[model samples]
Target: MFATVAFAQANDDLTINTPPSIVQCKTTMISWDGGVSPFDLVRISISLSMHNTETPNLLLSINLRAKCSVTEEGVVVEDFPNILPGSSFDFFVDFPAGATLGFTVTDNNGDKAETAPVTVQESDESTCLSD
Candidate 1:
């Protein structure tokens, strides 16, 4: 008798990095390594969510989309125009202090990455919890 096996391929070229912790209502930076060639337009899809840290139940979720340009060095993000590959892209969440925050990133070709829940710290006096 003969048996058949299956294998899945991975895109090892792409890499992602997110903050382990972030202050509530403040901008946080998330970056990723780039391997796509220059002059390509990449669709960026992002999702931000909050959950109760103690309970581990989801509380809120927000979805956002953007377009980025690929250059010889890396993808140029509109929010951070001068950034390079593995530099960073910024995001802000209005979650309350002590809430667990998480995010995901995906490109046009279905390449994606996600992070484990991170703790949200109390914001400074100048920061507002929501818009």
Candidate 2:
């Protein structure tokens, strides 16, 4: 299995450091200001606008994962703008290392079918967009 791993600078904006697998979009990576954050959980939300399509309720999924995501540490919280199905992007959060980055989808405008958040690495080389 092939995977891509990237590191973000301290108090840096990771959106500019887009990897080869990640497509540049409006996906905002809200990182740390210095040390810790005032909030506990770093929430990730998506804003998708689907137009005339065969399946209006077609579910498109994405797995946002990082090495340093923590509830108390205030890892990373990002907002995806105008995201569509099958489009690849990345979310950068201020995490340490070897920590579990669990993302809970909040205010899901796309009506994602996943009841739970998924942590996926860049491993899929195929797309099921034709269905």
Q: Assess every candidate by TM-score.
A: 0.51, 0.23
Model 1: how far residue 88 lies from native, Å: 3.3
Question: For model 2, how does the per-residue alpha-carbon lDDT over 17-86 read when each residue is reduced to its tens digit?
Answer: 1222321221333222211112222343222122433221222333244222222232234434443321
Q: Root-mean-square deviation of each candidate, in angstroms?
A: 12.1, 17.0
Scanning candidate 2 in windows of ten residues, the lowest lDDT window is 32-41
Report the number of the highest-TM-score candidate.
Answer: 1
Give the local distance difference test score of model 1: 0.46
What ranges in model 1 sit over 4 Å off?
A: 1-12, 35-55, 62-87
Tens digit per residue, CA lDDT, model 1, 20-120: 77787787777665433221222222222334334343233322343323222112222223233333567664566765545445543455555555766
lDDT of 2: 0.27
At residue 10, candidate 2 shows an lDDT of: 23
Cα lDDT, model 2, residue 35:
17
Best by lDDT: 1
